[model samples]
Target: MESKSSPCRPQDLGKFEVTQRDGAARLGKFFTKHGVLNTPALLPVVNPNILTVEPRSLWDEFGFRALITNSYVIWKNEILRERATKEGIHELLDFPGVIMTDSGTFQSYVYGDVEVSVEEIVKFQATIGVDIGTMLDVFGRPDMTRKEIEDAVRITAERATKSLQVADTKIMLNGPIQGGLHQDLRAKSAKMMAESEYQQSNFSIHPIGGIVPLMESQRYHDLSEIILSSSSELPANRPMHIFGCGHPMLFPMCIALGADLFDSAAYALFAKDGRLLSEEGTYRIESMVEWPTQSSHISPYTPAQVRAMSKPERTSLLARHNLEVTQRELARCREAVRNGSIWGMAERRSHSSPHLREAFLGIIRERTDPNEPSAKRIRSIIRSTDPIRPSSEPLSEDLLHRPHIIHANSLLVQRWRPPGSWHDGSIGAPSRVVVMKGGEPPWRASYGSTVQRVLKEDPRTVVMIDSLIGLVPYSLEDLSPWCRVEGSNIHPIGTKDADYSVDLESMGLGGIPVLVLTPEGSEYEQDKSILAWIDRCSFVDKLSVLCAVSPAIGCEITDEIRVRRSNTNRPVNVYNGEMHLFSPRLNDGGISLALHGAKLIHEAMKSARDNDEGSTITTTK
Candidate 1:
């Protein structure tokens, strides 16, 4: 006889794998039929009964790639059950992305009983084309006795076999860790579940549930420790789902600690409570000074306007707002991961949740201090329980100490220490020439080609200073070739608030003779300040002002400074209004333009450094 076929073949089976893990923290991805999911992601919770936001809208408007709904709820409702069974959860929700199903454990905790069996719910989830399914688990509340918690864990593990037996599809199963608030019991549950044959064959996620109440009650330290212990034991390959972590505040720290998946109704819950999710935490509409965002989504109505509307209307709009914020935060997390800055993002987020930050600080301090005993206690506890099965390579110390990079709040003193280069020696003090150049310009449209060519050959630290209109900083390299291709049409690299005057001295752009490229007919104040800074440098050194002039807007160094330069300690090499013009980098990479690229970039560097110019400083407030 032919061997029985595995439900999940190597080709069809999808799962998450940790690429980089720092202690309990990790960076990973989840693969599904729909697409690969970037991990440390929050799966928005959906209620079929409520239908607050359509799943498709969640994907489109909020960028939610995955969402979770209750398989038990669908099974109990005949209409939903029939539709789900016939077409699948994706068809029912009209969502093309991954759809996960909860197994009714939370509802049972709330209502005291549930109608469906564990096997029945798993079957329903599989039949509904769910991407992932949860095995019905007995939830032991935070106040439960140790015996009660142990009993719950045992029962859940016992039922795991039956649930897997009935799950006919390859839908991933969630094996929830239940131990109420007892750390040892939690570890015991994790160990017992991992040891079960059903666990080895079917479970794909180890979610720590029954802790929503704990988190809701502000038992955060308990929640933190529980998560640390429970997650530490689970197989690193499988994603760790936080069953009810919906609030944005918990995302960074949780993701940092190897929690790959999360689901929550916080957006809707907070919306109903008249609270908006902000980076700083939830806020009431009535207390706001100004609008948090300027997009059409929130710009349609001000917070005061929304506050005056009927409660239902206000709630719906606020729910949308909260969801948008949640999605944006998740996007930020993903971007940080891509740029190798996940820890940095987490550190910044810690500031918003002081308690969470305190919890982390406590962990770091305890681990770092020689006198702390928690290390021994923690090691003993984990070793004794041995929840996570020992894998080939254990988490390493080097991984744990990885630096957390964050945006500098003030003028950041980032040491330019690249492997072995300009970052090394203390060169002579800064020159006094300051250059003011137009950014996001007519030059970009008309002369973008030239900019790219110049940048390709330019050795100067080509800093693309911002006028403080956006939230983040950017570099000319980021805008490069793309800006040249799209020219004058290039959108601002950052939003409007990212404005910061070019502080040449601080930026290492100071006191070398300078080239100021101003766009003709542009009067942006920061651009003018750059020119003024250049004038200051002229007092001590030479200042060169280069303009990218359009025929329509005549290009001229309309003003010049004469040589009664200042006696600042810095060298004064200034080329006062020594103007030059260049076209944009050409679309086609021809020899002539390439030659021009080398020449212009070289001349700019020479003029900026050759003269003993005065120091120049530009400020944007």
Candidate 2:
């Protein structure tokens, strides 16, 4: 008997997998029929009604792999509707990358009401062959009452059922969460959309909608709350889109909050308004003497020359420049995430505007609020910290419950390995805890002799580094935040006498004698007697800090670890226990382990287990 082909499925269409993470920031790849989208990515909103910069240029020039256009806008224009339907959206736009289509939700918000029906828009997008199609959900406005917003959410959900049924197996649908400014309503909407029966089969992305007004008003605090409220209820596997957000200024914070996608028409709109987009903020092109950023489109022409061009020519030039700036910032964000410094990037960007800074603080406060259920969810997502601030920076209220710092401290208490037991078969905690402080790196050069001497004299001592974030064992010295984080050297005011007794207790090191080594300067002069004492210690009593692992460590630990920093400095491959690793001292001041070294450590641990040397390490965060 002839068997029928398997029906089309969402997995067959594309898939999203997180390759690396820093706090809520995820470096992921979303596979699509067209190509792979490296997220968190921005999709420039292209209007078919106008062609400021060709869609093809967005791909070839700017390197945007995905874009979004309004389906309803095409549907309203007979000529565009006919061309789109007959030739397909890709052909119509002359773009070869992934294309997403929006139903008239935003249009409805702007024009009071759209003529298209929910099912009608969904089916139309499918007919045009969009990679992702949005539903015709009701746009909830911030000014709406609770009951009104509730009705909007309910109506959107109701529309979703029929829209999904119509969109089945044809295209990926966007299940947007909308509830205006009400947190509870937003949560309710998110939960419903995330758990909907159709979501399992058809939904490709979850976009938080109805917050454009807030962004326009610069009410970033409320915007932050809305995002947190909606994201807490979203499915972790699926990407979350921050609808109508294109400005580079918002990318760092939004990406830090787990938003995987952003769509904005700002590049063109701002260009039309003579506004130039920048990471700091938008500036009027007419008022600028020099180009804020060098771009092929605007760099050749002086600001005065650009201002003298015809309006259409000027708009096109500025639009290209704006897109270039947006792309650059996105690249910067991706690099930050790779370096485990997204939080730091967010902090730096927040200083661009008072409202943005307030929004960032608001997000921190809300996430740290014990009473908020969403806060708990946020805390769970933070996996690592890239030392949110340097020891020299003043600790603000926002630093207390910073998600990355919290995650780091938690891991320190939980995953960190403690020294092995004594020869008497009795568990022996370290006699004293040594905290290394003062300048960065050359730890081996500065304190190597000191550490060796202390260990040689008393093998039971535990060495820990007091980083800007928290205390981490010597074994994790090369790990993120501790090694790669950059910040001030000054400690926060009023924290000099702060009590860390509870922190000590959490790591099971409470009641132990503590010794702190503060270097007088960048260099530490070694004492020969101390080194000679270290040489006398037994090998079993001294802990071994293993050398580099394999290249897999570079892949797994730091996402896309780069060796080349500049023309002057190039990385040299070195071996750590028969494993190849790249030393990136010149590029970035950090050590990367290779896969073989990692396996060597694993095998050693396994051998210990077989020989019954000691019990496996266990921890509680």
Candidate 3:
């Protein structure tokens, strides 16, 4: 059945806008001729030859905004080609939302070359009204040699311009990045596609192509490297598609790494193989007595009953179940992104499979590279200091190098008010740094006497409470995560057991002598050695928590900043210099700068000018 109303064709197709972001993950909208695709979204693969589940059901029932089909396959089939050309691909597929079409690249990789020319295939997809059409580029296989892969990249780059030219203004063309398993070649492919002359207007999406083999072999580390290497170089405005990556298990990690679109036939293929998809891994249907998950399609029937049904009937049911699982996982990922816990989700999912864990570690290592393209994007997304959220599990060492954490730490060192003389007041740096260990608020009550004694001995002493997440100062005791996060093992600061000297230095406390203060059952007396150490240590006060939350903007404020309590006396607004930064108390909510407050902070950071006439003190909800 044809769509009753024609789809809205946007004037500027492929224009992507980031509506929400958490770390490197973005909740965005990619406009297309068919409709706006809210991402990170899954495009279920629809094979024209076989219908496991109707595309309409995917839109109406499952709420899928988009689906992908093979244009080369439709073109090769005479009857299907005639119907597609006459009625448009969307009508033939019976899908009203966005429809993205592939350009035989995967087919050529699998079947050893397709018959259609690059230009011909792109033109066919555009003529058939495909919202997003992929260019017929060479798919570099992981097994190929470096020289062979280089050649593949070169050929793909050569074909990109002509394919995009054929696609023209009528449809948005996908510029697929191909470099097999070679990191350098992947970067090269990304650069070529992003900078190609054809990219001026036509290219809408950047799909990292030819990694299906790596995924199939469970070489997830290599896959992670390829994605990071390629995405780093691509244009930031365009949505990135992880070609042939459809499993629900891989979605969170890929999305965290900045993948916006995913297409795969895993739903149907796994269904045919009687495998069930879950966030953890695929489970074999025959081996399970009970359903692994709750799905409307499979919950009503027993496994034995499902097995007894005809092949088509069973495949359809399982296919629906697989799609349901895929959709549910994507929803979960989107929620995590909105909540600023995409990294936590990715970390949790990594433990589901050893390969995924290896891949996660590999990504962490690659992020350390200064030249990594994803680094800038990651830093941009993680500008807010509160992205490291409290999870059911304790914050692990893995968070030490998380792009967001690093960004937060950097900002803290740069912006937070150190204990020193300032334009607004003279707080002065501490003579000694006290790292408070093992405590819960009211921290003032627990360590109030200790802090008083230390300050009395040396008025410049800085007392920092080392929480599970990071080091926080006595002034910001009521601040979240530091105050709200609960954990059993709060490691002692300055001990060889937990080495955070570099982190401390990064938070602008380098060269300061630290005295580790351990409270025994909520009370402790300082000995002579501790007193002597306090005399030797340099002073830096109220640096840790400010740096922890607003690493970039925290240190810059000389004005007295206090947390304004809500009706429940919960810390909500950070008031400083006629400005306030609102941070929701929930674990997932991020710190949002009120419009006027943003101007004040930006001006203080010297990142913006004070040209506006209005008072910068106005509040935002």
Candidate 4:
């Protein structure tokens, strides 16, 4: 007998994947039946009652792949409700891209009640064939009592299974997380919605709801806390939407904290008031002599000319300008993510608003404590990233809190063992750690011979390179990203005496004596003389950082090492006595190993951890 067909799944309707990331912020692609939408993306809120700009223009002219409209607005109007159900949302709006519908949650918050039942809106959205639909979540306002907020969260969560059951298989559903201003409730709500699976139905997106009031009050600190709390519990693969956030000024910070989707009516609302959105902040046309922000919509005419136009004309012009600013800021954020510099961009943008700056500082100053739920959330973000990066650039004091750098430092403390062996078979006490100073990368050139000479004098000495963050062992001169800053004369690359002991203390090497010097004062030595030591020690460092193995065990894997020298007489490849086991990257100095060598590291990982002095740094904040 022939088998029956398989039932539809969430992936059958839509799929989401992370393409690139920095900290918690990521670039994602949402695949749907209509087309792929790249995020972090904005969906301009469309009101059925009015069309300020044609929906077709949003697709062809403005280049947006998705938009959001209120299904309740359509459901309330008999003409719109019938037309949408008959013709579908796309035809009614006259757009070809992905469209998402809301289920009157905000309307309920505003009007205190809605005529439709909870399941009615979900079924209607399915009937109209919206690519994505939001459930009828009860909006949890900031001023509500704790009991009220709890009820909101419980009710919203309870409605998820019914909403998912009613939504069409072709319609990807959004399950909103509602909890007012309480972070615990926010996390609780996210956990419930993300796991709201019932048969062939589950939410495709989780939007942090009840945040419009916070945004309205400029409660950016609370906004950030809400994001961190929900993001910590939300699935990494699914996207997180910052409900009602569209101001360009807040884009960098919101993206940095892990918002993948956003929707706002601010562009039209602000435009009606004659205010223009910009990367820095909003600008009022009446207060402007000229266009402070140059966009194609406003570039042709002077500010005075725009102000002189009729109200309807000016509002339309300003709305287009606001959209221009919004799109430009998102592009800038995507570029920053590629550069591994989104935090720096967030830093620069934060100063434009006092409240935003405070929020940014709160993230920068957060501490990792097991007792603090917020701290645990920050830890999840940092620990989730791969410390090895694809690009290099100049760094500053700003990178001290970089998640990548923190992860590497934590590994250095937890997995790395000090260099010093009495013989090839036994470990010895580390007497002195020679730190190379006033030298920049290519550290192999500036301090290579000096390190060799120091090792020649005291073979038990551990060689280290100084950086703006701290002192890292010479094995990581290039591999530990903090030491990979570009340009020889940059301040962040060179070592400073003030940071020496503190760094040593953190690494649990405080008892060892440190002697700081540069190649300029030292006698040169042949490069080949120390390649064996460099290869063996570098192997241990790489294993510690990347493979999470203790240096003691990593040493066992590299015991039978045979080195291949580059044209510059530097170690290029490592042979485990006979088998080719390791190859070091020329560009970044990171290690690449043969599959056989990977097996060895994998076997040794059972005991991977720090010694008495070694411990995992609270990898974030």
Tens digit of per-residue lDDT, candidate 4, span 1-621: 111112224454467878888878899888887777889999999987888877887777788778999999999999999999899998999878889988999998889888888889888999998889998999999999989999999999999998888874747899998888787888899999999977856899999888888888888888888888888789888999988999999999899888999999999999999999999998999968888888999999999999899999999999999998899999999998877778768888888999998887777665455554456677876786567675674465456676777776777777666764622334567778888878777777788778777777777787887766667788777774755666547454444345578778777688788888876755585755366667677777787677776666676777767778879766788888777777888766678888777776665554343234223321110
Write candidate 3's Cα lDDT for 187-213 as tens digits. 889999988766466478999999899
Clashing pairs in 2: 392-488, 392-489, 392-490, 549-593, 549-594, 550-594, 550-595, 551-594
Clashes of each: 55, 8, 18, 0
Better of 3 and 4 by TM-score: 4
The superposed Cα distance between candidate 4 and the true structure at residue 81, in angstroms, equals 1.5
lDDT of 1 by residue, 422-533 (tens): 1112233333222223455323333333333333334222324332222111222122122222222234343333223444445444445544433344333233233333
Cα-based lDDT for every prediction: 0.57, 0.72, 0.73, 0.80
State which candidate, 2 or 3, has the greater TM-score. 3
Give lDDT: candidate 1, residue 441. Answer: 30
- Tell me, what's the RMSD of every candidate? 17.0, 8.3, 6.4, 5.5
Which residue ranges in model 3 land beyond 4 Å of their true spot? 1-6, 369-401, 414-417, 421-429, 480-484, 488-514, 519-621
Count of clashing pairs, candidate 3:
18
Q: Please give the range of 10 consecutive residues that has the lowest summed lDDT in model 3.
A: 533-542
Considering every candidate listed, which one attains the maximal lDDT? 4
241-286 in candidate 2: lDDT tens per residue? 9999889999998898888999999999999988889899988977
Sort all candidates by TM-score, best to worst. 4, 3, 2, 1
Best by TM-score: 4
- The lowest-lDDT stretch of 10 consecutive residues in candidate 1 is 415-424
Q: Where is model 2 more than 4 Å wrong at Cα?
A: 1-11, 17-20, 31-33, 198-200, 384-405, 415-440, 448-465, 472-480, 483-502, 512-621
